[model samples]
Target: MPESAHVTEEKTLSESNPFPDSIPERLRAQWNFLIEVDKLKTVLRQSPLAAVERRENDAEHSWHLALMVPVLAEYADEPIDIGRTIQLVVVHDLIEIYAGDTPLYDAEAGRDQEARERAAADRLFPLLPDDQATHFRELWDEFEQRRTPEARFAKAMDRLQPFLLNWMARGGTWQAPGVTADDVRRRKSVIGDASGALWEAASELIAEGERRGWMRPGQG
Candidate 1:
């Protein structure tokens, strides 16, 4: 082959395969972590899409929450760092890639959820470079603890998104056997700690769901 043609072929191969043998360990680790988290796309949740028949997955759920942070920032009970809040939203559910999703209403499945997710985090987060793995884990832990304003607001969006989905689907999960408005109210009441306005709106949606016979009537 001509030298020029050989050079052109090498260029094409190099362009197509971006990874080089000398790539730093940090870059390789970060790339692997990004690729591994793609499994979140397959981790399905209980909430249904408002416009379609299928359920949403964890990746979609996190993206929705990230979007909600900036759009609904004004409703947060206290001021929040929008970028940090979005980061918290994105990190919150990545562990489900390894742990799998636990439905909000599934008491049986939830019994061991924290243990499962903690184990999953131990395996998954270390895929990243050490600094990033620690930062992301801290964000995940913060979201779980809900101790900061950003974490609280992030949690509110987490709770509120599924609530909105159920309302839009005309009782998506609420129609499940043995679930009731009271159960939902108790579970989602954390929304109040972050955003009273959103929680009030959520309460209204729950009441409307009960009125429409979408929810099992809770005994007073």
Candidate 2:
């Protein structure tokens, strides 16, 4: 096949839909933003998918967290707006579409993770329409600050989702070098801030992992 023929075989998203010149500017911006975020599906994380051999991507992680909100909201430490919590979780990691995933166990990467994500948020959020851009950015901010009940529960779901995945993976990231049961306990303890019940469940799983020799007890 000729190079010109091959070029058409692999079209970039913008090329896939050659928008008409008459299309509204607002719709164009919105469509472009949606297409850009498709990159989220490519940003892989440390947690393995429960049913798959490969790591989950940011898109899958965010979707799992959003789905978990309704199922687990009843366990929250305080009442939260379920819809708002879902929104927070959905937007929380979209910044990762640009900043890229920082694995839970990577302390060196974590040291500058916030700075990188903040810069990402600045660039990515504005891709939406002005109103949606502000709203989504605020939702992202709330999830990061974790000040509101919705944000807290959203964050708890975020932490718990990977914890559940690791258990399903039979230790997943728990098996990373030098990672101990106590380390898992300390990192996942934040789940308690929003749901003591979920934390208790998670605690049991951590203990079980230790008992199974998946992780050492570390300092504790």
* Strongest candidate by TM-score: 2
Q: Which lDDT tens digits does candidate 2 get at residues 138-220?
A: 99999999899998898888889999999998889999988888889989988999999999999999999898987777676
How much lDDT does candidate 2 score? 0.83
Q: Candidate 1 local accuracy as lDDT?
A: 0.85
What are the Cα lDDT values of the candidates?
Answer: 0.85, 0.83
How accurate locally is residue 182 in candidate 2, as Cα lDDT from 0 to 100?
Answer: 82
| Reference-based lDDT, residue 71, model 2 | 92
Work out the TM-score per prediction. 0.90, 0.91
For candidate 2, give the lDDT of residue 14.
Answer: 59
Q: For residues 54-112, could you state the per-residue lDDT of candidate 1 as single tens digits? A: 99988899999999999999999899999999999999888776677888888887888
User: Backbone clashes in each candidate structure, one number apiece?
Assistant: 0, 0
